[model samples]
Target: MRIKYSIPIVFFVALVIIEKENNIISRVSDKLALKQTPQTLVQPSRPASARPKANVSVTSQGKRSSDFMLMKRRLEDYSDYRPAAAAAAAVTSRRKDILLLATTRTGSSFVGEFFNQQGNNMFYLFEPLWHVEKMLTLDTGGTNATAAAKAYRDVLQKLFLCDFSLLESFIDPLPVDHVTASLFRRGSSSSLCGEAVCSPFVKGVFERYHCGNRRCGPLNLTLASETCREKEHRAIKSVRVRQLETLRPLAEDPRLDLKFIQLVRDPRAVLASRMVAFAAKYKNWKQWAADGDVHVDDDEVKKLRSNCNNIRMSAEMGLRQPAWLRGRYMLVRYEDVARFPMRKASQMYKFTGVPFTPQVKAWILKSTQASKEAGGIYSTQKNSTEQVEKWRFKLPFKIVQVVQKVCGPTLKLFGYKFVTSEEMLTDKSISLIEDIL
Candidate 1:
């Protein structure tokens, strides 16, 4: 039935049909009253009523029992973690060594703004210890925990806890085994400074080890009553032996302050990056395996391995930190930092005793933009998978398959997976490596 219609008539008919179809579809949909699929549930909008309250019921000075875990997680949500102004009200009167450890792909760059904002009041250092080992590792392997401990004890008096707080411990949190197991945490060394923090004896310990002004006078008791009265050059002789080993000397000072913020990220996205750079760019797994020279044409591999190793080592260090240190620490994840960087920056601003004002928040926004524009090979939106998982299409199937096989175990630990290819899922060679590139 061929029927000819004028252009205007055809256009009117199409419009009428669309409007009718839409009306019909709406009626049908309303009548059916179909519920959304269970798997497609929307995340509840975080309204005011839905937010948790973090007000400590007790007076600021009193001991009120509350689970830190609950508070920490809720705090990450940002509504409960408002400036409280306690952070800005806190005053700083001493020099300290602040440690901010990052487990790559986390927003440590955003955290960098906290120290950067302090201007000249603080002598800020980022990943100094990490840098020392990284440069030495692939070449000399010259450094170890003992050496790090010694430097921390003798040189730096005030320790700052700027990265991941306490981590999962194997046994007693203070034991070496605990530290070893948590190779991804940071700043867990309060066991060495409890008495110094709680009692006046800390000054005595500091005097015995940290007398920068030897010209002032001898620190030893020349008059009588101490164990080392016979020691010569009393000032130099008073230096504590333990200080030579690790951070023992700095622990005794009146203001041996420990401040830190921990940044975490979902390991899945972190591991997925390997697929794009290491496996994809090189074209296949067999080629990457054959060229293991990190110093050669594999800068991305070097960076990935370095960050992974750093995360592992820092986690080890974090489990051993004491409760006192843990109290001043924060546990922030990468997801939270990206979704609401202002919230995380405000937390850091508060923790550092600086006012996190509107101006500061604006600056933080600028800093975040700068971070995105000036990142390395693994650049993406800080949290969401849309930018990170682009390798699904950018990469060839064979290479992704091989990476899934070679580093799959480690990837699982971080929570990523290799799924059946959309186009080639039924192929038997999906997970197998091709002999040729």
Candidate 2:
């Protein structure tokens, strides 16, 4: 009986030892697998209570004395390292350039400002390609247009590469327009200025523009500073490039990580806004035309027509793009952004890998105020839904008819229904137009 009991005890002891050894091997394998994973994804989860509390009791010497407290502090020290490493990784890996591609009167300026006002991390250039457009004086088709398109791509490449020195060779002081000049002036404020205002960078723009006085110097200085090297994100808003294909090379370039946000607005709304702005800017349209050719295309009507067609073409290009190509190009509508500012802004920030900081949120709220207070067609200060449907009232029935005829299909493609003449004759139409005007 004693021998039988001894044999069973020995067998049980051996089984226990083997089980413990197996557990040890399993633990070792798990540790090895954990080590192989990228540090960014290796954050270990713990209970909330496990975190070190500052309010916990301390010893006479000010050190945490309790075992739980001591363990908590140690865990926190280890935990703290992860976020720092993660932030550094994010900083090194985030996108470098964002291009807001749109045609005229699509609220590109507003979108540009939205990107720019995010914080110091973001540097924005409003229509850097407008400089190129001014230089070429070319139309948007044929071999000349192709050459011009190449030049535009080249100039943008230089900007993305952060080499403003090249602007000295080709670009000059852009004529001080009220809209852009005001934006440049805002650069004087602490919230908007970038490194270009300081030494080394400022010299490049001054030399490029041959800026003799402060007349338009600040504007050029801001532009030069905003595009300088070493920023988390850099952006430029362009109305000059009518088609997305023109920017395909820049988007595909390996040397630069580029993102394109195709900002669009309802064609009818854009037309009405463009006409209103043109009328406001040039009080005497006939005299303005007689004085000089205002645009490559002559009359305001012609300009509006060309602009609507450009919007249509841009939409077609975006709609037909392949899935892989779509990753580089994101389409944003002015109506959606204006109607749902916070949500749309968040989407934009998320898409660009930009953090939605408190400062950016505050600026978005403050900037969306209507032009009524500031008194300009270019003012995007208003954050109201009113702007989204303003074209319904402001655009004349004939102009609406023309836009609906040309852009109806594209509008439907984007989910906007075409309005019929019978609908325009409704009492709601006349009253809505009168109330806003």
TM-score against native, each model: 0.41, 0.62
Name the 10 consecutive residues with the lowest summed lDDT in model 2.
428-437
Candidate 1 lDDT over residue span 1-437, tens digit each:
23455777888999999999999999889765554232122122235254222232343212112122233344544333344234424444333334454554454544554554443233343333442233334344334545544543432331132211121111122223222221211111111112222222233232222222121111111111121112110100011111111332333344444444555443434445544445554343335434532223355544444344344223322322333333344445555555566766666665544445665566556655553446566332233323433444444455455444433332332233345575653343443221111
TM-score of 2: 0.62
Could you give candidate 2's per-residue lDDT for residues 1-437 as a string of tens digits?
A: 99989999999999999999999999999997787452222122334355333334444214222222332242223342344335535766665678888877877777777776777777666666655656667464223567667877887888777665444345444334211222322432332344355233333344333222232333443355444554667777777776666677786787776767788777777766766776665343334334533332345545455455555455445443333344454567776677667877876766565677888788878777645565367665764666766767665555565566545434544445556674753335342211100
Clashes of each: 24, 8
Candidate 1: RMSD to truth:
24.5
Candidate 2: stretches off by over 4 Å: 1-92, 138-144, 173-192, 195-227, 280-309, 320-326, 422-437
- Please give the RMSD to the true structure for each candidate, in Å: 24.5, 19.1
